[model samples]
Target: MTIAGSDSGGGAGIQADLKTFSALGCYGASVITALTAQNTRTVTMIEPASPAMIAAQMAAVFDDLDIRAVKLGMLGDARAIATVAEGLRGRDLPLVLDPVMVAKSGDTLLPDDAIATLRDLLLPRATLLTPNLPEAARLLDTTPATTEAQMAEQGAALRALGPRAVLMKGGHAAGPVCTDLLVTAAGITRLTAPRLPTRNTHGTGCTLSAAIAAGLARGLDLPEAVALAHGYLQRAIAAADGLRVGSGHGPVHHFHAVWPHV
Candidate 1:
């Protein structure tokens, strides 16, 4: 289940999550929390669906589907977060939270007040929390410097926030190699890949988290699942670099290696 908002551009929010799930060979389901008039260039406007509507959608999905894992992306406000949290109570399922606070175009997807709600309620319930550099900094209330040590330290701090594991993504940092550190009470595992120079990075975070959810649904452990998901996203990004879809920063091709249409 992908509980998030709709991206009209079909890049970043629920759209990207669903594509990633399908690409990884998992049945995808969604419970939309909001809708945004967004493209590769910018988010023009946001229309948050009522909390009751969001809850109803989740209930409907839970009632019908045998959902194994849930990938949560953008929840616009505190109420939306609360609604999802309330709906998820007592379910023993893998919940992957991609703390999508800011978009690639620098728009704030989650409100300031909603951050607290996310930390208080959602983080504790999540099986794994994936946060990029900025999101990790916000969650830890510290500036993340460009260093591997700092990344691991921050990842550890994020893990202490109640999630079973925390993946601190290093894509936002200044570096030649991008590293994502997975921290848990057990230990830290680092997954490194060469950062491809490309503009088609619109849905990277969503794709990574969704891929991890797919892996979890397929019964992989936290460390193994995150490693495979990171590798998959790296190849997807490299293959999608030059394929232009929209005017501005475009999306990574979800079906980069699938097949040519008939």
Candidate 2:
């Protein structure tokens, strides 16, 4: 299940997550914490759901569905964070937390004050914490890592903050190859892929994390899920140019594997 926000443009947030879950052969449930009037070009407005409504949505899903794993994204504020934390407390399920702080268009999705609330309430409960360079830096209150060594260090640091594991994404780093480090207490697994040049990468982060959650829901271990999700995202980015979704940074092709390229 995905507990996140709604993107009216249908490229990121809950929309991308649901698409990824379906593409990876998993049934998805959602609890929307916020809504954004957004497109590929920009986010013009954001409206957060009331805490009661958020909790009600969560209750409805957790009540009936046989949910296996959960992916979290784009939680707007402290209230929403606390609500979700309480809702999932002691559920004993695998939780994938995507620390979504910014959009592809450079818009801020999460405020600075709410970071503390999220770290306090949700970080310790997460089975896997997924964060890009900027989001990681924001969480740690440090500069973004520019080297693999630094990424490993930061990943270890984040894992120490109570998450069982951390996946430090290297997409923001400059290079021809994008490297992601899966940091666990046991060791670090380095995943590298050739960076495809494409601007249609709007929902890459959401898609990757959701795919990992789908794998986890299907009983794959953390390392296996991360590997499959990484490869899937790489292919999606490679096929992104085949789509013409918007004028700005468009979305990755979530159905790239299933849809015939025109």
TM-score of each: 0.97, 0.99
TM-score of 2: 0.99
RMSD of each: 1.4, 0.6
Candidate number with greatest TM-score: 2
**Candidate 1: misplaced stretches above 4 Å?**
260-262
Residue 178 local lDDT, model 2 = 95
**Candidate 2 lDDT, tens digit per residue, 76-155?**
99999999999998899999999999999999999999999999999999999999999999999999999999999999
Query: Which has the greatest lDDT?
Result: 2
lDDT of 1 by residue, 140-182 (tens): 7778647889988888777778899988889988878888888
RMSD of 2: 0.6
TM accuracy, model 1 = 0.97
lDDT of 1: 0.89
lDDT of candidate 2? 0.95
